[model samples]
Target: MTEQYLGLPIGPADTAFGLMAEYDADQHLNKVSLIAGAYRDENGQPWVLPSVKEAKARLAQDQNHEYLGIAGSPALINVAQSLTFGSNMTKNLDKSIASIQTVSGTGANHMAAHFLARHLRPKRVYIPSPTWINHQTIWAGVGIHIEEYPYYSAETRGVDLEGMLSVFETTAEERDVVVLQACAHNPTGVDLTHEQWARVAEVMKRKKLYVLFDSAYQGFATGDVNGDAWSIRYFVEQLIFNGEPDHPGLCVAQSFSKNFGLYGERVGVLHLVVPRHLAAQGARSELLGLARAEYSNPPRYGASIVETVLGNEELKGQWLRDLDTMSSRIKSMRRELRRRLESKETPGDWSVLESQIGMFSYTALSQKQVTRLREEFHIYLLPSGRVSICGLNEKNVEYVASAFREVIGFNSN
Candidate 1:
């Protein structure tokens, strides 16, 4: 008898990172990359928030390479809790919430999936159809049944509220998990309006669904951290605060990568909030156990940097301004792209460019059009038509617009 040890099928390269590799290998002089979700400045360079720079300067004198606890930095968790749920809510949620630091939003999501798969054992997990590619990958690891509910309406370039709610009402059973992007949904950039949020909350409350709110773009969405958090807060209020006792509470997977410009640092927090009458101490212990087995300890340097900026009033203010700077630039580029396309009489509705918020947009370009832009124009974007608005800048935006016009079969006179 023979035993086979190490034979495995090769897997395809990650679409985004694979394209990133191609973009990097490219030596084209006028090449433009609308690929990664990281923010880029007007000059199309990676930008570090001024607050983060200052925080690093301060930490450089006193920072150590010591390992954080398995659950990560408590100080960072404290500030992150306050950031996501606001200070008052953080205080009020004392007995009801279990929070731990994670590798990043990805780790938080992974932890939630693993924890729920073991503990809550939901029958299925529902995610937006065109969500961040990683969402599906993360859930699949936990061996849960994953389904995609309709999300963005291509016809209207908006949230498919009716379609989403119909699935929730008809198909979703109690304790089933639903992954909701807290703000500025990835790929599509479309968010539920406040009224729409309330409707979903009512259904979730009624259906007794467990929610995993992915809070990746809090301040980065519109530069107003509080405003971006409205959905999470509202859901907490509706589903947890005012709902029935049997309702399995919601959790938020918060990330510091985008808002703090600490992408490479891999800092994030996972908050599991239970009902008011229940204590989250047991769940907290389980999360800590999972964290201990997975990574041992979260990174210390990034947590210090985050805590430093968020803990101090002056640095936090500067961070807010930095958010404004990044968000405003993204908005302006959206306008510029739309203007250029419209002025050139490009095909289809370009107004979605301006209406969509945050770093990426569901561009609606077909795979063929996307390929043509890459081959002919040296422009790189996801084949699914998701483009990182951050990649557009003053120098390359017009070129990108023209590439779109050409690839979409529009040739202006």
Candidate 2:
């Protein structure tokens, strides 16, 4: 095709999405797809949570097809904020939080980059080396000088807490932004313990570096909302509330796509929080302006469903159970895979599979091993060897383990 635009270079297809397409085209009957981050049922199908189904049914009565204001639904913002910070802190931190409903987690992250790159004007923004694939692309689009700090150590198969703190202590400057995954870290499911978080918080407070918390999996991580949010809340108490006067404050980009199982609905919120001495009204207005320029308002239906589920007591109970159901199944898959791999004496330490939390597991499988899994066994996962634990179920866990045994070779660990 002739160039439709003057100076546009051909871009490669998105890695994850392109691979998903390849998985879709494969005709193998026993094909297992551990590619997507989405949740699947025991039957290996997309699940609509019972709570969400009920919420949709309730929405069947009162529905409106109107354009939400530039800032989107006010109700969603309130519930989202409450869910993020919990009710007490939401009230305690009264005038210090600037929150706006967003297109989704991606939209919230994008808006944050847009606002911060222009206003805070940090010399460098640091991200984890093996974070969500979109983190790099999203920040890059906003034209920020991006730096990657060490996060996961492949040799240890754990958090590189010291390395992470060293970067913040030495290289990071005041007002420099640090992106932190609140819990259930993507690709590599390793999350820092409370002590580890506290150590990092000490460095961040001393350095006066700004924080941007990306909370994509709340209750979805461990079936406990508060447990998953412990890191963020700890940072809130340590950095903003009790830190030095020069503390730059922090923001949270909360996503409802996973926890609420409303992925396509695209419901999320960005919360910009300042110290009690600072006011957030001006920041809220600025966020409104950014929202106005890009995608004006967030989707209403998803927000409404989430709001309904969270607002009603019985539905909220159902939602909690749903969270447990999803998380429990992912955990089970992890155990089953580990049990099978170890029972067969697969090479290396298979214990990491059970130890890593949430949807993904960094199997540390080599690129060549991953390729062989796809080509020979019709199994699909990221080239980085990140496997979606949700993809395995009673039906395919043994198959996946056997495939791993073949690629990795058999050895006692």
TM-score of each: 0.97, 0.98
lDDT of 1 by residue, 1-413 (tens): 45445755568999999999999999999999999999999898999899999998998788477888888888998999999999998898888999999999999999999999999999999999889888999999999999999999989889999999999999999999999999999989899999999999999999999999999999999999999999999998898779899999999999989998889999999999998888999999999899989889999888999999999999999999999999999999999999999998888899999889999988889888988899989999999889999999999999999899898864322
Whole-model Cα lDDT per candidate? 0.93, 0.91
What's the distance in Å from true for residue 136, model 1? Answer: 0.9
Best by lDDT, which number?
1
The parts of candidate 2 lying over 4 Å away from their true place are 1-4, 410-413
C-alpha lDDT (0 to 100) for residue 223 of candidate 1: 96
Clashing pairs in 2: none
Question: lDDT of model 2 at residue 411?
Answer: 24
